[model samples]
Target chain A: MRRIMTGPNVVLWLFMIVALLTGCRGGAPLTSWPGLTVAEGIVYVAAGAKVYALEADTGNQKWEFPGEEKKGPFYATPGVEEGLVFVGSNDNNLYALDAVTGNQRWSFATQKPIIAGPAVAGDTVYVASADSKVYALEAATGVGRWEFTTGNWIWATPLVADDKVYVGSMDHKMYCLDAESGQERWEFEAGGGIAATPTLAGDLLYFGAYDGKVYALDAASGQKKWEFQSGGWVWSQPLVVGDTVYVGSMDKMVYALDATSGQKKWEFATEGAVLAGPAFADDLLYVASEDKQLYAVDAATGQKRWWFTAQTSIFAPPALADGVVYTCSQDGRVYALNAGNGNQRWVFPRTEQ
Target chain B: MSQVWNLLLQGMVNSLLFLYDVLAHNFALSIAVFTVLVRLLTLPFTLPAQRSAKAQQELQPEIEKIRKKYAKDKEKQTQETMKLYKEKGINPAMGCLPMFLQLPIMFAFYQSIVKALANTPLQMVSLGKFASPSLSQLVPLGSHFLWLDLGYPDPLYILPILVVATTWIQQKVATPPSTDSQAASMTQSMQITMPLMFGFITMSLASGLAVYFVISNLVGIAIQYFITGGGGLLPQRGKKGK
Candidate 1:
C-alpha cells in the first residue's frame, strides 16, 4: 500500500507552500537600537511608538508624548536643548516636545523615514533622514530653514560645532556644511557608507564606516589623517577621550586606538557584535553589545571591570548623566545603573512586582 | 533546529552579497543570477519529481482504461494502478519529496532578498549578523536600479506585470493537457489563480523579490519546455508553421 500524489494533491501542496512563503513574511516595522537619552534628571527615550520621559533616578514615568501611540515607531535618541527635546520618527517627521511637559511643540516632516537623532545648536535643529537629505529646522517652530540632499541615506546624526555641521551619508561620503545656511563646505569620500555619527575632538574628526574601517580626518579641511581596519563594520561612533579613541565593531571586538595615529592599542572581545558607541566617565568605558550585556571596560587597559546582562540584546549606546549609566534593551526596557558598577538601580516600563 | 535553518539563511545571504560584489554591484543582476543558480542547484530534487509527474501524465490514458476494465471491483482498480506504476517505474511519492526539499530553499531565498535589501534597522542588524565579514560593505546593497528601488515596491507596476506574464507563460508551457476531466479542470484553474495571486503579492513586495520571481519563472519555463518537449506554448506555433 503506497501513497500516490494525485494532480489535485500537487496543486494543493503548491498552494500551501506559496501561502507559507508569502503569508508569514509580514514586515515587523524595521527595528534597530532603541533611542535612550538621559539628561538633567530626566530620561527621554524614543522606543516603540512613544517617547517616554522618566525620572532619571527612580525610572518613574514623567510623561509620554502625544498622549496616544503614534503609527510609526521611533528609535532615534532624543536631542535635548533649550526647553525642548527633539527626536525623529520613522514616520518621517521630527517632533519638538517641551522638555518638562512632553507636549509636542511642533513637528517638521521629511520626505522619508528618520533613522538618526536630531542635533540642535543655538536656534536650529539639524536632522538627517533615510530620505538621503539633511534638514535644518527652526527649533521653536519646526519650520524648514533649508535642506541639503545627499547621494544616499543619512543614518548618521549631524554634529554641529563652531558654526559647522558635519554629517555622513550611506553614499560613502561625509560632508561639512555651514551651520546656518545648509551650504556644503567640503565632502570626504570614504570606502563605504558611514552609519556612525562623526565624533569631533579639537581639529580632528573620527568615525567608522560599513567598510569595517575606522577613519580619522582633519575636521576643517576634510582630509584623511589615518585609518585603522576593524574586523567588521564599525557601526559605533568612536569615543575620543584624551589621546585614546575607543570604538566597537560588528566583528565582536572592541578596539582602543591612539587618537592621533589611528593605531590599535588594545582590543577586548565580546560575545556578540557591538552596535552601540561606548560611553565614558571616570576611568571606565560603558559599552553595550548585542550579547545582551552592558560592559564596563577599563578606559586604559581595555579590560572588562564588570558587566550587567539584560534580558535581551542591548544595541543602543548607554548614556550617562549624574553618575548614572542608562542602558536600553531591545525588549523596550531601560536599566539605570551606577556608573562605577553595572548594578541596575531601576528598570523602566516596569514589570509587575 | 533553528540554528541549522539560520546557517542555511546565512549561506543564501552571503551568496547573494558575494554575487553582488563580483557582478559589478548591480543588485538586480545579482538577484537574477542567484535565482538561476538556486533553480539549477535544486534541480536534483525537482527534476526527479518533474519526470515522475510527466510519466504519470503520459500513462493517464492507460490508467483510465484499467479503471473501466475493473469497474466492477474497486480493489482491482487500485491493484492495477499500483501494478502499472511498478511496470513504468513511476512512483507518485517522488513528487512529495521534491515539495518538502524545495519548500525550505524557496522560503530561505525569499528571506535572503529581504535581508539583503535591509530597508529597516532590525533587518540591517540581522543581515549584518548573518552576512560574512568579507561582505560587510555590501550589507545594505544599493537598492536603486533603473527607476526601481529594490527595497521598496515598484511604483510603475512594471515588475508585477512581468511577474504575472512570465508566471502565466510558465504554467501554460508546463501544464500537460490531460484527458482526465477532473485533473485538467483543477490544473486550468490553478494556472489562472496562481499567476494573478502572485502578481497581486508582487504589487506590494520589494521590487527585488519581484525581480527574482520573474527570473525564476522564466528559468522554470525553459526547464519545463525542455522536459516536456516544449509543453504547449511552442507546439501550436510549430503546427501553424507546418
Candidate 2:
C-alpha cells in the first residue's frame, strides 16, 4: 500500500503547493473610475468609498461625506447645482450632499446600481441606473417622482434640454421623454448600444454608439439628421463648440465633424483608445487617452497642441476650470495641468514622499 | 511575470470571445464550449501521462517484490528500480508533466472570465485593454444562466455541490490504487479533503468559475474512465468478496 500510494501522494502534495501559491494571488480591490467635477471654488472627487471636497487651487481636503465607511465605491461624477452635490454610487443609492459642508441631505435608493451621474433640472433630478430604469426624483426631498423603464441597463447620464430628457440604453435605443410626465417623446434606434451621454447643440442631439458611428438626430422629433461611421466604438460624449463636434473613439483617434452635416472635418490620432470626452477651453480641446497621456488639440484644425504623459492610463474625462485641467489616472494619482502648454501645475498625493 | 501572464490571458480572452461569437453570443454556451475546446487541446499531453500512470500501476507488484528483496540494501533497491523503469520504458516523472502544463492555462482561464464579467466602471475600462473592438461591442454580456448570475456567487449552492461531486469522482478515477494500508488511508483522506476544499473555495468565487470546474472535472473523469478501461481507485464490487 505504501508503494502504491507514493506517486499519488506526491501528486497530491504538488497540487496543494500549486493551489496555495495560486490562492495567495487574490484579486485586488476594484478601482472605480470616478470623474472629478469642479464647482464654486471646490473640486469634488470620489475615491474608494468616500466623496472628497478639495480646495480647487490648493488640493487640500475640505471634508468627506459620511466621514466613515460608506460600504460602496462611487464611480459617477458629482453634478453640482443649487448648492447641492449629487453623485451616484455602486451602493444603489444617489446621494445628495451639501456642496460646501459635505453633509448628506438625502439619498434616493434604486433597484440596482447607479453608474451615471444625475442631471438636475429645475426641482427634479433625473438619474439612470443599471436596473434598466431612469428615475426622476424631487431634488429637495428623497421622494421618487416617477421612473421610466428601458429595455436594458442605462449607463449614459440623462441629458435634459428644453423640458425633455434624452437618454440612451444598452438596449440599442435612445429615448427622448417629456421631463415633467415621464412620457416618451420618441425613440431612435441605433445600430448598437448607446453608452455615451448625448450632447445637445441647437436642435440636434449628438452622441456616439457602440456601432462605431457618431449620429446627429433632431432633438425634438428623434429624426436622424446624419451619421458618420468611425473605425471603432465611440464611447465618449461628443463636445460641440461653434459648428464643430469633437468626439473620441476606441479606435485611438479623435474626429472633428461639422455639427450640422456630420461631415468629418479632421482627425487626430492618439497612441491608444480615446475613452474620455474632450473638454474645450481657450479654443483648445483637452482629451485623455487610455495610452496614459492627455493631449491638447486645436479645436478648429484638429492639430495637436501639446500632450502630457500621465503615470498611468486616464479613463476619466479631464475637468477644466480656471486654466487648470484636472485629471485622475488609474494609478491613483490626480494631476492638475496648465491647459495652455500642458505643464504640470501640481499632482495630488505628492510623489515626493 | 504578470505582464507575460496578462498577454497569455489576452489570447485566452480572445479565444473565449471567438467561441462566444460563434455560439450566438450566449455567454453560458461559450463557457461550456470553451471548456471542451481546452480539454481537447490538452489531450495530447494528457494521453502520455495517462499511459505512464497505467504502466506505473501495472508494475506495482514487481516493484513491491524488488522492495522486499532489497529490504535492507537501499542502494541496490534504487539501482534495481531504475533498471525496471528503463526496461519498461517508463519515466517516473512523466505523470506530472501534464498537471504542470495545465496550471498556467487554468490561471489564464480564471483571469479571463473574471475580467470578461466585469461589473464596475473601472473593471470595464480595464477589460477594454484586453478586449478587441469587436468584442467590446458585447460589453455587459448577459450573465444569467438558468438562475445563476455568472458574475456573482451561486446563492442556491447548486453549482458548488456539483463542483465537489464531480471533482471527487475525477480524483478517485485518476488516483492509482495503492497497496500499503497507511498510504491507502492517506489517499482516502485526500480524496475527501481536496473536493471539500475546492467546494468551499468555489462557493465564495464567481459561479462562472465553478461552472468551469464542474465541467472540467466531468470531462477529466470521462477521459480517465476510457483510458483506464473502467478500473479506478474504487475497488470492484464482485472481486471485493475474494
Candidate 3:
C-alpha cells in the first residue's frame, strides 16, 4: 500500500471523478408529504412511519401509532369514523386504530402500497390501493366485504356518497361501483390517468386528470358532460361550493371553474406544483403548493390574501377547524396557523433552540 | 448550476417520454430505445475509448516489460510508455476524456428513469415539472411490462440476473491480458466484482434501470467484441488477442 501514490494529488483526482458522477437524484422519495386531517379537535397526520394524533390548537402530540416498532412510511390522510382511525401505510396495510389512544384496532392487507386515504361510510371502509384494486372492508373488524379490480393503479381516495362509490385509477378511467357488492356500475375513460378524488355536486362528478384536464360527468351514467383543460396534471380534488369548483394543478396554478359549464373563472399562479386539494372556509381558500408556502386566497376573487412559508414544500391540503388551519409540510412537520391573518400558531417538532 | 442540470434532465425525461409515446407506450421498450440512442450518439467518443482501452490492454505486455526495464527510473518508464503509445497511435488520455464525459449522462439517465416512472406522489410531481405540456398525458408512462413493473424492481429477479450476465460478458471482453501478476489479479477480481456489485444493486433498483443496464451492457459487449477482434472472455491477459 505504501508503494503507491498516497497523497493529496490522488485524493484530488478521486474527488473530481466523484463530483462528476453525483448530483443527479437517482431515486424517488421513499416517503411523501405528510397527510393530515382535523377531526374532533385532534389533527391526525401520517408521515414517515407513524400516524400522530395532535391537538388542533397547540400542535401537541397526543399519541403516535405503533409506539415502538417501526413498520411503515404512511402517507395516506387518515379517516375517523365511529371512534376508529383508518390510515393506510406504505407497508401495504390499512390499520384501523382507536382514535383516542392510537392503539391498533385491526389492519387489512393490500397487495401493494395504499397511498389513497380510506373512506369510512357507515359501517364500511372503502380504500383504493396501488395494486389496482379497491377493497370494501368492515369498519370494525377489517374483514373484506368485497374487492373490485381495475386496469391500473388506484391513487385517489374512494368517493362514497348515497350508496355509490366513485374511484379513479391510473388506467385513465373513473369507475362507479355499487357500494354493497363492489359491482361496476359505470366507468368513463379520460384522456389521462386520474389521481384526484372525484368531487360530486348535484348530479355531476368532477375530477382532475394527468392529461391536464378537469372533467365533469353525469355520475349515474358516467357520461362526459364537459372537460376543461388546465396547464398541467390536476392531482388535487376539486373543491365544489355553489356553482364554482376550485382545483389545483401541477402547472403551478390554482383554477376556478364553473361547476356545470367547465369554463374557467380565474387562475392564480404559485411558484411550484399544487399537489394537494384546497379548503374553503369564511370566503377564503387555503391551498398548499410545492412552493413551500400555504396560501390563503380570497375565494371569490382568486387572489392571495395571505401566506405562511414553511420549512419546506407542501403537498398536503390544509385541514380547517374553528378558524384554525392545519397544514403538513413535506418536511414532516405540521403547522397550525390563524385562518384570518395567516399567523403561525405553532409547529410540530418545534424548531431546535 | 442546478438550472442547467435541470434543463438537461428535463430534456432526457422528455426524450424518454416521447419514445414511450411512439413505441406503443411500452416503458421498457422506450428505455431500451433510449439506451441505444444514447449509445449511438456517444459512439463517436465512447467507441474510441473502448478501442483505446482495448488497444492499451493489448499493448500492456510490452508496456510491462518497459516498466520493468526502467523500474529504477520513474521518468524513463513514463517516457518509454509515452513513446510506445504514440508509435501505436494510442492516446492514453483519450480514454479518460470520454469516460469523464459519460458519467453525467449515465447518472442523468438513471435520474430520468426514476422521474419518468412516477410510482409515488413525490416522484409524480417531479416528473410533471420536467414533462412538456404536450406530453402531460404521458405523465405516468406505463410501468407494466410482462411480469415486471418498470417502476419497481423485478420480482422474479430475471432482469438482475441478466444485468449480471451481460455486464460480466462486457467486462470480460473489454479487459486486456496483463503481464504483471498483480495487475492480472486485480483485473480478475474487478471483472468478477464489478458485475456482481451491479447485480446486487440491481436487485433493489427499479427494473427500468436494470433494463437500461442490461441493454447498455449488451451494446457495450457488441461494440467491444467488434473493437477488440473478439477477445474471448476467459483468456489470460498477457495472451489476449495477441
Candidate 4:
C-alpha cells in the first residue's frame, strides 16, 4: 500500500528532521581502542569514543565509561585496576571511571587531547597529553599529583618503573621524569618524535623513534644503552618476553632482539607496515599488519605459524587470552578466534551510531 | 600547470595549513574564524554560482517541459536537454562548480595534516627536508585548543557536535526548493541523510577535518549573506557591472 505522503516531499521532510536531530545530537562515539589491557578477570578495550570492560571469560559487557565533555573519541588504551579505569580522551580530559559500574569517579582536566594511554604505578597514574605535557595524577582521587611540560606533544604511554616514569614526546625527547615530583630527571634527544611506548626490562628501557632508530637507554640514567636501525619508523611498543624484545616497524619488518644486549635475534618481513604491537603467549608471537593479515610466528625461529586474512587493515593488536584471540579490522569488525588453531569463533560488526 | 589543478592543490594546502594552525590553537574559535575567511575569499564566486543556480531554477519549468516533450525518446531527450541549457545560457554543472573547485583544496588539506602530524620514522625521513629542525622541536603538528587535539579523534566529541550542528544549519539554509517530483524527493532524501551521514563520519574520523568542514560551511553561509542579501541563502544581486 502506498503511504499517504510519497515522492520527494515525504523524503525531504524525513531528511530535514533527521538532519536537524543529528545536528542537535552531534556527538561522536569512541569506537576504536589504541590498545587493550586485561587485569584480574576484566578486559579493557578502547574504541573510537569510549572505554569498555568485559568479563575476560564470557565477553559479556561489564561496564562502559563514556568520555567527558566533547572528549569524543579516545584511541588510548585504558589502564585498569582496583575498580578504577583510567583513560584519556580527545576532549583533553583524563578521566577516572568506576571500573565496575561505569560511573564517573573524577576527572583531571588537561590543556590538550590525551591520545596516549595512562600507565599506573603505586598510587600514581601517568598520562601524556597532546599539549606536550606528561601528567601524574593521584590514582584514587584523580587529583593532579604533578605535571611536566615537554617541548612537544607527548603521544607515548608513560612507562613507570623504579621511581621514574619514561615517555617519548613529539619534541623528539625521551624523557625520564621523577615519578614523585613530575620533574624531568633527564631527557635524551632522538632524531625525531618518540611516539612508541617505552618498554622496561631489568636495567634497560627500549622505545622506537620516528627518526628510524630503536634506542635502548639505561633505565636509571637515560643514557643511550644501544640503538638499532630499522628501514622505517618504529611506532609499535617493544614487547619483552623473557630475554627477547619484539617490535614491528612502519618499515614493514618485525624484529626480535635480545632484551639485554639489544642484539638481533631474527626478523620477519611483511608486505605492509606493522603499527600494532606484537602479542606473545605460549611460544607463539601474534602480530597484525596493515597488509590485512594476522600472522602467528614462532618466538624462537620467527617462522610463520599461521596467517589469517582480513578484508581491511589490521592495525589493532590482537588480544590473546585464555584460549581465544581477539582482533579488530578496519572494516569495523571484531573477530574472536581460537588461539590454538586460529579458527574463527565469532564476529561482531561495528555499530556505527 | 592547469589553473584548476593548481587552485585545487595550492588552495587546499593553504586552507589545510591555515585551518590546522588556527584550530590547533582553538577549535571552536578557529573554526569560526576560518569559516569567515573562506567565505570571504570565495565571496566573488558566490554570485556566479547563485546566478547559475537561479538560472537553472528559473529554467526548470522549460526543462521540465522539454523532458515531457521528449519523455519517450532517449536520444532526442539528451539533445533537447542540451539545447534548452545552451539557449538559456545556463550551465547545469555550474551549480556544483564551487564545490568541485573546492575539492583540490580539500585534498591538499588532508595530505598536509597527515604529513604534519605523522609520528612514524618513515614520515620523519620526509620530514627532515620539509620540517625545519628548529620548528620541529617546537611544533608537534598536534593542535591544542581547550582540551581536544585537532590532530587526533576528539575525546569529548565537542567538535563533532559543532560540526554536525553547523553543517545542518548550512544545509537547511542552502537546500533549494524543487518543482519536479522525482528531483524534489531525491533532494529531500539527500538532505536528511547527508547531514546525519556527515555527522557520523566526522564523529569517526580525525577531529581536524570535521573542524575544517564546519568552519567552511558556516563561512560559506556568511559570505553568501553579505554578498547577496540578509538571508545569505540566495543571490539577491544579479550581474550589474558585468
Q: Measured against the native two-chain assembly using Cα atoms, what DockQ does each of the candidate structures obtain, in the order listed?
A: 0.34, 0.37, 0.29, 0.10
Question: Which ranking of candidates, highest DockQ first?
Answer: 2, 1, 3, 4
Reproduced native contacts, each prediction: 0.21, 0.16, 0.27, 0.01
lDDT of each: 0.84, 0.81, 0.84, 0.69
For residues B44-110, write the lDDT of model 3, one tens digit per residue. Answer: 7677676777677678779889988999999999999999999999987777677667666766777
What would the per-residue lDDT of candidate 2 be over residues A1-353, giving only the tens digit for each residue?
Answer: 33333322344345445545644221223666657888888888876577878888888888887776554577687898898899998888999999889889999888878888899999899999989999999898869988999988788899998999999998889999999999999999987778889999999999998778899999989999999988877889999999999999988999999989988899999988888899999989998998999999988888888999988888788999999999987665778888889888777767542
Ranking by lDDT: 1, 3, 2, 4
lDDT of 3 by residue, A1-353 (tens): 11011111122234324423642222335566579988989999998887999988788899999888976787789999999899998888999999999999999999988889999899999999989999999999999999999988898999999899999999899999999999999999998889999999999999999898999999989999999988888899999989999999988999999988989899999999998999999999999999999999999999899999998899998989999999998878999999999998998978752
Stronger candidate by lDDT (2 vs 4): 2
Residue A353 of model 2 has an lDDT of 29
- The candidate with the higher DockQ, 1 or 3, is 1
User: What tens-digit string does per-residue lDDT give for candidate 1 at A197-312?
Assistant: 98999899999998889999999899999999988888899999999999999999999999999988999899999989999999999889989999999999988899999999
Off by over 4 Å in 2: A1-29, A351-353, B1-11, B21-25, B132-136, B229-233, B236-242
Output the better candidate (1/2) by TM-score: 1
Give the distance in Å from residue A29's predicted Cα in candidate 1 to where it truly belongs: 2.8
Which CAPRI level is candidate 3?
acceptable
DockQ of candidate 4 compared with the true complex: 0.10
lDDT of 2 by residue, B146-223 (tens): 888787788899988998898778778877667656777887887898789888877777788778778777777888
- Provide the global lDDT of candidate 4 against the true structure: 0.69
Residue A159, candidate 4: alpha-carbon lDDT: 89
**Candidate 4's residue-wise lDDT over A1-353, tens digit each?**
01112211233244335435533222232244445677776667776565777666656777666736445467677888677888888778888888888888899888866778899888888989978888888899988878889888777888888888898988788988888998888889987778889988888889997666788888888889788877776778989999889999877899998887779999999898888789888899998998988899999999998988877778777878787787777554556677777887665443443
The TM-score of the first chain in every model comes to: 0.94, 0.91, 0.93, 0.85
